[model samples]
Target: MFDLAEIIDIPPFSLDRQKKGELFTRALSDLTQYHQQNCHEYNQILQLLGGSKNSFSSIEDIPFIPVRLFKEYELLSVDQAEVIKTMTSSGTTGQSVSKIFLDKYTSTNQTKVLTKLVSSFTGKKRLPMLVIDTKAVLKDRNLFSARGAGILGFSMLGYDVTYALDERMELDWEQINAFIQKHKNEQILLFGFTFMIWEHFYKPLQSKGLQLPFENSILIHGGGWKKLIDEAVDNETYKKRIFEVTGIERIFNYYGMVEQTGSIFMECESGYLHSSIFSDVIIRDYKDFRSLGFGEQGLIQLVSLLPQSYPGHSILTEDIGELLGEDNCSCGRLGKYFKVHGRIKNAEIRGCSDTYAEGKK
Candidate 1:
């Protein structure tokens, strides 16, 4: 078993490309064998790809299951009795959702790695948080949708947590203003899915011509950019409009999924999503699934050290992205950083915010 504690102790972005690659290759290779031995379906898939030989010299040598497999099959490396929580991907009325099983070990380490990755940007202290979505999302505890899991996951980084919208997806001005007034002098944190922040929080405030009194606050949002792209909104415009309305200069958009929840690639001041020591992103050719060099856009394959309860260690996602560079970001981070273009065209609209928008239609 590859103990995650060894890498968790290191600073999230401290490992350079060479060092991180060596560690990841070892850890993920071990996880491959671990899953093959414990998960029958995973073993069968590997056997079909080739023989069930798990030894691999490089990260690219490891085979990855399509991310959508979780939607079609129950792929568990651990026994059903060991699952502590099941996380489902966000989907509309008839769309199938991915189900991720988590045991105590996987669950605990997910939080631990997430804390380290987020703290690299937010610092050690937990700030007062105002979530842009309604509190109703967190109602179901055991089976969590990606939206709810996202809310609950990021909520751990803040204190005096508050939701900015009501159950009807209406902006609660009174409550939001009160929260701002109470924490007016402190540095606060705001989180939400990308579209929800735009539709529920930003658009409402913009229409009302209401500016918040958040002198020092950071807004962290993710889920997907499909809805925003439909509106022709780019990252720069999103940040500019948000700054105009809220005066929040520090806004970060992270890239992650329910399958690889904890190992998020957070955006830096340089506007690139960075991979931490515990996780990595590889761009693969759309047709052949071969690894692409930096600056080439293709399907995104995500690998993380946090998924032990299930065979989700390395997954080929439907999203497309291009690797910018490694160990040379202007932000001083020492890992691979890249930009997410969006989901593959004609792919199912399944992001948390995107599904919410579809349901409304």
Candidate 2:
């Protein structure tokens, strides 16, 4: 069995996704076995569920943490000193959420995955990445939130271009225009959350009748349209608006959280978010944990192989998604491509469905 401590301290220097997945599977199985032996909470859950190492033959067998647990528990398997940074969710002012911690190696591995995944998708070695907000917001030490963790983790990828750091996250028109002018011919990558880019940046830019001077510019945003749903935008309208404002063909949406460090499912050209190497996407029926097949929409349960500081072997996300199954992506990546339809309103909220089914594939 591989040592959990060694996995964290050493760099997993593999570029091949399948090989990386093998390493992660083995390492995490060791960690889970270790936790089942050491951590009280983990041990209890395993005992109750009749857990065994054989259960994790595939990613779908991994147990997922309810997103609400972070809000209720300390939720760290490592020592306090080992935590290099803490990130919180940007849900609202008083209702803050926290993701425990990140060690240097964990953070570095996460960045490496981001760079490789994004680079492969955009087909550009490095697009001039424009920061839509402040660097401090990216890696705050204050509270816990998955959104904070995501943005902060992204900032580590040394991107070019001036960052907009207004407290309100409002973009300065002149600065944006000047930056566009400086790299007029370069294909730029604009990154931000769904609401922030839509309400603050896109709308304002479109209203000004201003467009960037690049042909291959792409904008990548995460989170759901729930924030814009209140405004009655809907999915089709939202995508159209993004295309209109960005003036780019490659507008991508990503599905991920702070809990699972490196694995993120990114929206490809075919309008589906493709799963990364470090994780597997399983669509469990809304009420039951039984696995659903392709074209079926249900509660999205992610089995992540990216986490190290915690027991993130499996996490049942509040997001609702549809699995498209394994197929040839036009982008050339193999594996199942899934689309996130939307997220359950709150992390703890459940749908009104019968929990009669319980089967695994």
Candidate 3:
């Protein structure tokens, strides 16, 4: 029995598409049946959708549940006693949030895969960390909203970590200036949710006419682009504005949901999001669910080998995106690259971001 979960921690993190394809096919096929056999609800959906009940050869053959199902049901393959934590997605304006149960193995694997992904982008050595969100987000140990989970997950990559926002969710200028002065002229790592980085950190500093000289910093931000789009801030504008305000230019925007945390797609300088080895992305036509060719925008179906405790390994998300190409990026990274075009219209608006991006208090 090939345990599909093994690949997430397997060695040789080098870029290899041939190896990735074989591993991805088998792992996804095995995980599909694993969830089907253990999670009755998932199996029922598979049968309902006419999905393969056995190993799959094509990634398109994998059946996926709509991400919203997590909020409506507790779908777990592991026994109750095995659950070590329950993570919740960030709540939208009025919609219910997803509650994902995580066992020790699943949680540990998620962290490990995330570590690999981050290390690939921001070198192996840990750097001085500056988080753009307030310190209060980490209070909940059991239930992690998206922002809370993000802070905790990335906090593992750095030492002497400092929060950039204060209790009021406002920029902590005194603390930030002090921290910058303390770590001046050193490589630094920064993490934050997208909206908060713009609204809370970038805007305040820009308005007050202050600059940090973080030319040696690398920032990783994701989540809640809906809010950014609301403000007419495209990725280019966002990056340009940030560069004007601060000297930092090494910024990478990633795309992920609480449903599939470990299998994130991060941006490279080529301006496309690259799929990691542990996961693959497919764009499906809205009506027939068939795979669309490159540059064709459609719904994003994400497949991962990371979720063993919950039936979240493969999910049909509400986001619209297009797979750009494979192994041909200017940044010199391997694997398929893609672009997200925000969420599908009329999908329930829910994310772990503040409403402030829409000009609301």
Which parts of model 2 are misplaced by more than 4 Å? 1-28, 94-96, 134-145, 345-361
TM for candidate 3 is: 0.95
TM-score of each: 0.98, 0.82, 0.95
Tens-place lDDT digits, model 3, residues 1-361: 3553556555323456787777777778888888888988888888888756577777777788899999898999999899988988776456688989999988888898888888888988999999998898788798887778888999998989999999899888798889988998998998888888988888888888887788878989887788778789999998888888777788899888888877788888868988887778899999988999898999999988889999998899998999888777777777888998878888876555543343254
Q: lDDT per residue, candidate 2, 263-319, as tens digits?
A: 787777777777655557789987777889989999888775556666666777788
Instruction: Give the TM-score (vs. native) of candidate 2.
Output: 0.82
lDDT of 3: 0.83
- Rank order (by TM-score, best first): 1, 3, 2
RMSD values, in order shown: 0.9, 6.9, 1.9
TM-score of 1: 0.98
Instruction: Using lDDT as the measure, name the better of candidate 1 and candidate 2.
Output: 1
| Model 1: lDDT of residue 283 | 96
Index of the highest-lDDT prediction: 1
Q: Which stretches of candidate 3 lie over 4 Å from their true place?
A: 4-17, 354-361
